[model samples]
Target: MSEILHSPGVLALELSPGATPSSFTLGREAADALARHIADDLLRLLPAERDGAGADQADLLVLGALYDSVQLLHPGWPLFAGLSELAHHSQALAGAEGGRIVAFGSHAGAMPGDALQPLVSDPPSPLLLVPWTFSAPEALATDLGARMESVFMAKGEAGRATADFLMRTLGVRLEHARYLTRHDLCALICSQLEHAGYSALWQMLEFALLYPTRSGEASTARGQKLVFRDGAVHCALPVYADWAAAFGAGRSREERVTDYAGWLFELRQYVALLGAHGVAVRFDGDAGATSLPAQRLAEPDPSLPPPTLFSHEARGLGVVVISVAQIAPDRRVRLLAHAWPLDQAGFDVGLPQFAARYGASEQLVRLGGIELDATADDLAVTLPGPAMH
Candidate 1:
């Protein structure tokens, strides 16, 4: 109760075991881009407080296992890519104070900072560690760094039980147990981008080298031009060796997997946010295998219970997240989409604005409109701004 009410702060990053990451500073643009990408998803995992004036509205700390995992996956890309970036969003989140980080369950990834000094040029910053295990307080302290102090301790199952205990002891009905999918994670990234105030230069790929802008200008010094190719929309990367660092290129096999994961995560988030906000939604197929009847979506009501990880499979053929959102400058709505089968990322789902195609993006647009873009594969239309709100 004291922890939930008094310490209205959230430590939302994922953690994993690892050594110190190589030195690299986050660029202002890239840092802002990364922060914008993950904000909403991080907020979702934090505690909420409706009755108090500023009860549940705490800044989120997107640190931990998943964050550490990304560094391990792309060692060359700096450690904790978004912390410095998120610090810019200090008005909303705690940024990188370190001490606010809370650990529940196992923290197999945490390494003592002092030990990494000889190998790592700079160690991780200081953090406030809180452990919620009356069950295993010592292990929790050790994970947070041996001298760490736990803000609260409780005895129960790992996740929801801990949350419930806070609710019971704190006297606040904290939003119940919720499961987040890769889809929601991606959408949060998109949401954060929208929130970050970048109305122009945008991130088309979550883990990519090229993030295109709204105009004819190039995304980096490498000067990659915006071009539509292979049904995937992008600002084509000109030289892998020539403009390597700007795009995070050279790490090919890993980046290939990144596009698939990043796009899929962003897509689901786009669909849910659009639908919950009252945008009309229609799945691809009719009342059968693929699509659901067109309808205004229900706002996520905690009183009705929540969904699990495997829930999407029960819906069949999978839904291509399609919606028209009111993103920057447009008081009205612009279309957005992430059809799983389609290879495109960050498309202007607002098809009437851009030219057409015979691809799945075209299929989704046709559901909302009449004609398709000309089927020339090389022809890609340039959108005026970032596809964010």
Candidate 2:
């Protein structure tokens, strides 16, 4: 904290146009703080200290963690100053003891050409990993011990903060786009759908974590499921993020509803990604329709209760949104969304043809009808081009 406050022109963070950091500024942080985290990771890899041999000597020996941390904070290129700083401190500390100054270089998959042509090293040391040398039994006990420590340490907020520090540092060290997982991608897509006018974006993360909700009514409490059947997929939002605020106190109703609007377009860009990958989407039927797999089960079947999700399909079932999550290997995925009604002319993905309906009968949801001011400006960012890589 003091270092960040005192340091001038310290690199802080980096992010895409609309993306937020994971817990912290991520790419932006003081170079030293980032270096410290790297140092800590290497320290963890050392054997348990019986006499502080590894502890005192490890910092004096390895500069891998610090340099790797820098790469993580600034991926695609390695900073010479940052690397030199680590090497200088480490070599000085070792002080002619023949202590090896092992430090990180261009990361795996990263090339010398990836960095600036001016980049140079004073004395180079290759990146290294701590080898697993413990016997099987010893390794198992160490694993269990670490797990136990995690459980007990989480009791303290300090532990949680430090744990997060380590986790985020290690996360970037593992891979470039390693922050996102299947579950997070679900939340990401679902959040975007919510930003859209599509309202069925509830409890979506629960589905990603516990996919294939075929276990009966008990699964309903967990929320909706993204289903694929007969060459089509179905999904419905079971809960809303604004509604989650009910459990806590913060925003007023208007503020909640207003800020709530951006959830969809935030992820709206993903819509085209789905389509580009040969996915077909349609919309039909009411979003609040009472349909579920339980519809086919016996009346009052105690074993099969109704889940919040819709099980079977019907015509005119208006779908709010459709999102997809890749299932690895070949990027195959299960489409998740509300029930979309099929049409001969394809998806009528809009409020309805007003000119054709002008002579016909259809109810328009007006501001007067809903008793809200329609004079408010429309606030939404149109989806940009697809950016899936």
Candidate 3:
């Protein structure tokens, strides 16, 4: 058995767009929230002073969910640099007992440019924009041991001040901070689930970590049996013995059938246990696929029509479409939104109509079998798409 270690604190900051004064105001509110949540913890928030100074009594410093005002003040500075400066300043303000600085920000479509372009060309600096994780700090402390000295970096400076302020107020460090890859994070999640007795989820998560799905192929076969392994866990339709084969192997047919039935009962129990913990299970044979057709509605037109409304073969069933579009130079659009089932005519016409209404192109390419409610937004939207390989 592996011993699992936990961190002293885990903090999350949400960075989105807002007005200049409003953004700053929101940052302050978020900082206060962090302070309240982690009261009695040594943390310091920043942007309380100019010239990038520190708060003297904090244990950890965080910065960002940066606003436009700060970015405008230092326009030429790379976004992460401003974030780092904010963290450094907060650290200086809070006379902390040498804890890690944690900053949180977006890694998705939040930025206008290539989201993958390094925020800083140099080594790991103060400003580190990291994906929001509900369990990052604990995982980091466990994985990186004592060398976890770190800061959160984000795509922009929009919410940097708020994040910095929050960390400054509520964060405490047991050691230095170190960054973890997305895969590492997922693995940590699996470990947590395993601890929580969600062994099935752990197995599925393990599968997802091992054999990540390709673009649009969220579920696939493992053999003659239709196996659904999403790099996380393995799920499948209930197995059925070929009746013809069973008849041919006539010796002790009843006993073999009884054994198969017993096995299936145990499998159902396993699936039920997963369900008890809010993990969803769907049998493959019972599941229906969402279909989006590919057809060029207009001739060489940049502004294409929307998809038509097709028939609702699977009405009342939830269907999520994951669309990945290349928006600009090195920038891509990954959208995951639920679509109510459509009648066949609606399927053929509704999407094109919607596209036409939205002034988007009508070239519809089908990426198959996305998770029922999963979207591109749920995961990171880096250029060249989500499969790391």
Clashes of each: 26, 24, 84
Residues 1-389, candidate 2, lDDT per residue (tens digit)?
11111101111121223332222212223223433443343234333355323311322221122221213222111233333343444323222122232333323423223432222223321221111111113333344234323432222121233345544654432211111212232444456546763333233223322342322111122222334322223433322332233321475545533333333222222233322222322222233322211111112222332112211211223222222111223332222222222221223432233112122122221111101113222111112134212
Between prediction 1 and prediction 3, the one with superior TM-score is: 3
For every candidate structure, what is the RMSD over all alpha carbons to the true structure, in angstroms? 22.7, 19.1, 19.1
Q: Whose TM-score is higher: candidate 1's or candidate 2's?
A: 2
Identify the candidate with maximal lDDT.
3
Write candidate 3's Cα lDDT for 180-200 as tens digits: 333443454566656864444
The TM-score that candidate 1 achieves is 0.19
State the lDDT at 236 in candidate 1. 25
| After superposition, candidate 1 runs with Cα above 4 Å error | 1-160, 163-178, 198-203, 206-389
- State the lDDT of candidate 1 residue by residue for 1-389, as single tens digits: 11212111122222123322232222233323333333332333322325211112333333222221112212112222333233343343233322232221112333223211112223441111111111112333223221111221111112544444333432334333222322233344446545763211123233222222221322322233333223222332121222234444454544523332343344344344332222222332222222322222222333332211000111222322333222224322232221222213223333322212112223322121111123311111223245411
What do the candidate models score in CA lDDT, each in turn? 0.27, 0.27, 0.32
- The parts of candidate 2 lying over 4 Å away from their true place are 1-32, 38-204, 212-349, 352-367, 370-389
lDDT of 2: 0.27
Error (Å) of candidate 1 at residue 293 is 51
Deviation from native of the Cα of residue 42 in model 3, angstroms: 7.5
Using TM-score as the measure, which candidate wins?
A: 3
